[model samples]
Target: MRKFLCTCLLFLLLSVPLDAQELDIFGYFEPQFNLIYLDDNYYQLQSNKLRVDLKSNLGENLEFGANFDWIVYHGKREWNYWNFIPERVTSRYSSARMWRYRFTFDDRSFLDNAYLRFSFPSFDLMVGKQQISLGTGYAWNPTDIFNVKDLSDPTYEQPGHNAIRVDWPLRAGFSLLALYSPESDWESSGKLLRLKGRWQHFDFSITGTETEWGVTDYEYPFVNLFTSHKRRLLGGDFAGELLGLGVWGETAYNFVGDFEDFWELLIGGDYTFDSELYLMLEFYHHSLAKSDYRDYGLNDWLRFFYQEQKSLTRDQVYCLIQYPLTDLLKIGGSTLLSLSDGSIALVPTVLYSFHENIEFTLIGNINIGKEGKAYGSSQGHSLLLRSLVYF
Candidate 1:
């Protein structure tokens, strides 16, 4: 770890020049409200946040940056909540330090990003906490091992990983990257390497990742989220135009320590109408899930909360459409269907732009399913209002 820190420091010193511009500081304020109905119960969340960012040039090639988020949220629920602690699924117990501050009741603050980066004509390097987003699948990303985003709220940015990344270009359409995310216990760290290229009209990439996950309380029940096993991931993705439609695919094969190997796959396509309307459809399958998992007891949900499992269903499909009704108003909607349990969730949204830097959105989520099916048991209906301001 010392060597890693020193290497980044050395590069910054060598890359910075004598003269550079002043630091740039800016951010935005956002406010949102949500109302959900589940089993005739009402739950709501009202949130307001202030984000501030600072970026300064160490020189022409080097830079320093950081961002902080302060949020205040309030809501009421009809039922009690569980899942205490923080970042149970992903956070390594043997991390360097806790980089957050919070009062879960109403106020929360944290430094979301802090990093040093060096840019060059041919290659670039970045160190510190940063988001690693890879893959092409819209609803599901089997190739994005570093980022496991929530399917319901797919566009939100999850927590960043602490790592050092080196990106180099091999040619006009070929490149590769190497990344290392170290932990206090080296054995639990993650390493990844990826290669990307193009052939004909298609773009493709192959990646290998090494991961060590810690077991959580849900796994052992009596224990904490600290025990885990090592696993290796081999994944690839491809995207291109097919039959006059945008087509993409992603797949990943996982090799666990002592368990049977499993795989995940996603295939999707999209089309546009006169550049005004867009439509997309996708299918995803997870080999690790049982095709007939009808025992929807508390234990199953516990497994999900404990990070001991992935999806509950083996097969699923998603469809979405977006169109602009006028110069200031737009509409979009999506539906997710779980093939295994024959459950479906529908979300419709509307966006209105009052100015270039300000916008408002209204969203609705509705779920339908059998008593013991995937979508069958959800917060029946939800309504949300989101507004954003940029400065």
Candidate 2:
């Protein structure tokens, strides 16, 4: 059904006799391989992905854009016997549930972005599925509710949200933005309002959001289930240049029904040298995080895995250093350190552009910690190789 719809859309676009400047098409293809080693065992996986993007000018003040992605995967699909356990705790008494993991190589296709925009003299309106990314933090975006960040690949593109969005420019450097995402009921729907502006050399935004967030909550002795809860969020972010470094911070306070209220904060700064070396450091804090490793429980793990919680530990630090070895090659390394438990995750990356239209990346993840910590040695380390070709 999806493939047929995509084919028909392509045929319709091709059948149209519009000016070349009226329509634009672009996309990329990626092939990837992954290997993981843990507890003296190794697992391998492979995937191929294709993305197609389309943009067109329907008429004056009207435009349309869409992105389609199709991906296929193969290899090992399940792993049992690994779990998060704190020090001095046995598996039977562990607070966190044992892992139930799988990597399935199924063919998946989706429309990541499909939206229509109407521009007026005073405001702009957008409708349909579209990317709604917010916040200034790179590794962690505490103020963004529509998406979750993968710690290992923080900058990857995220899925879109179905919403109606409006942007109203208030002044030369200020604007008001609103978004509404309908759900089955009014209470469950997502709504947001933001005021953004620039002052001197800094840009800032204040936002308010209300919605029902789906999450995994514990249901008694060893049982965990998915559920939804209402939450109201008030947040703000600011980015500016301080001295020669780029600095940014994002903070959010959540009021959740039937859950503890807490705060999330992230601060980071980056600098690039004349020699092309770049360096960044960031700090993240979660008020709801467990201060002691032993205080971590099954509920914590469940919520973290389900995207309700940002971190199981109270504090973390991230550092990134990257340099271009040549015009075609770049190397970088990043470290995520858990200040609450002294665990660390090291990620080293290499990128090479073999051709103007083709690029390859090699990434490695190594965890160092005692058993039961966030980045524990038992959590399994992995390496990934991926190639991207652009049309």
The candidate maximizing TM-score is 2
Which runs in model 1 stand beyond 4 Å of their true positions?
A: 1-19, 77-106, 215-226, 297-299, 303-310
lDDT of 2 by residue, 272-335 (tens): 9999999999999999998777777756765675577888889999999999999999999899
Question: Candidates' TM-scores?
Answer: 0.85, 0.90
Looking at model 1, residue 220 earns an lDDT score of 36
Which TM-score value belongs to model 1? Answer: 0.85
Structural RMSD, model 2: 3.7
**Per model, how many backbone clashes are there?**
3, 3
lDDT of each: 0.75, 0.83
When summed lDDT is taken over every stretch of 10 residues in candidate 2, the lowest stretch is: 95-104
